[model samples]
Target: MQKQADRVVQILKSKGLRVTPQRFAVYANLLERLDHPTADQILNDLNQDAPTSSQATVYLSLQTLRDAGLVREVLLEQGVCRYDANVEPHHHFRCRCCGKIEDIEWDAFEGLSFRKLRAGLKVDSYEITVNGVCDRCQH
Candidate 1:
């Protein structure tokens, strides 16, 4: 079967965005590794093959991808920013011991009535992050 993730990249390109090698590498990295990587982590991972991706390049590429809604950013303890490739209204979990991030299945908003409470408030995004030890670190 064809992959749905590849369609995401195609949609991004059709919007007139330049698909650079570095950007493609970033997307591939995200696809391979589901862990939420900080910009530095992404740089380190990319450096394994692309030994010259400067920190600034990663930041710019992340911004471009995020702006296109292809990626989403999450903040954890101490204002640390982590990135996730799945952007379809999901929750996140962060490990306190190793700072690893994982996606958690949650649908707690099904009964919420935020619009009724605010009377005119427009809610666009939702983020939920829980911090604790991951299974690997506990071993």
Candidate 2:
């Protein structure tokens, strides 16, 4: 946990972002739980240590982190937005029943190409989310 916190601090510093307690706590929480939690979920978890931490603070912290490219937003069903700390080039797998989100390694689709599919449009980046029953939900 300490290592992860330190890494978060370093990332924030590298991005020229102030390393505040709230931001550290938020980033650390996301690192600890790669489940892709929502802002409310993150706030609920943070309240254990920082009862005064407001939803707006978490939201802002998340926005800053996202802008710094340290975090990515995952939009699942019903316009719900979840935050993911893994910024590496990768995809996602969402459990249909439990709505659990897990990382799908980049290598899984390394050979994929869409140059022909996106002939005219300028492609910046892309993310794919596969929905299915996870292992726990399968059983």
Candidate 3:
């Protein structure tokens, strides 16, 4: 809707990035989907709405959004990248049976001690991806 587009524009402008129609459309698509989507998937959905974007534009928009810390990358498989709109601290769970990814509450691992690591390896930020059959798949 117009609200989503305006919100995307606000965030992009706050980050001092150029707001192109293609970029806004791509970002709007990302915001609407909870599923971590790849650039190709985003493009396909965008094509359904407006079929004027190239794959490269999607990729560039994703890169820009990630660089601005508005989106996060979910790299579970080699050469297969997914995009997450939830930039807040959290982990991920991947359903092996369905290849679905869901966010895990970051507080669940609150007590994890990074001090247990070997010397000189400073810990910054990390994301844990739990792979297993999800609840729906277990049925």
Q: State the displacement of the C-alpha of residue 2, model 3, in Å, after optimal TM-score superposition.
A: 4.8
Write down the worst ten-residue block by lDDT for model 3.
3-12
lDDT by residue for model 1 (51-102), tens:
9899998998888888877788877667778777888887888888987778
RMSD in angstroms between candidate 2 and the native structure over all alpha carbons: 2.1
Count clashing pairs, candidate 1. Answer: 0
> Which is superior by lDDT, 1 or 2?
2
Off by over 4 Å in 3: 1-4
- Model 2 per-residue lDDT at 58: 98
Give the least accurate 10-residue stretch of model 2, judged by summed lDDT. 110-119
Per residue, candidate 2 scores C-alpha lDDT tens digits across 20-128 of: 9888888888988978999999999999764978999999999998988778888876878999988888889999999888899877876777767756887788888
Pairs in clash, predicted candidate 3:
none
lDDT of each: 0.78, 0.87, 0.86
Error of 1 at 33 (Å): 1.5
| Candidate 3 lDDT (Cα, 0 to 1) | 0.86
Q: What is the C-alpha RMSD of each candidate to the true structure, in Å?
A: 3.2, 2.1, 1.8
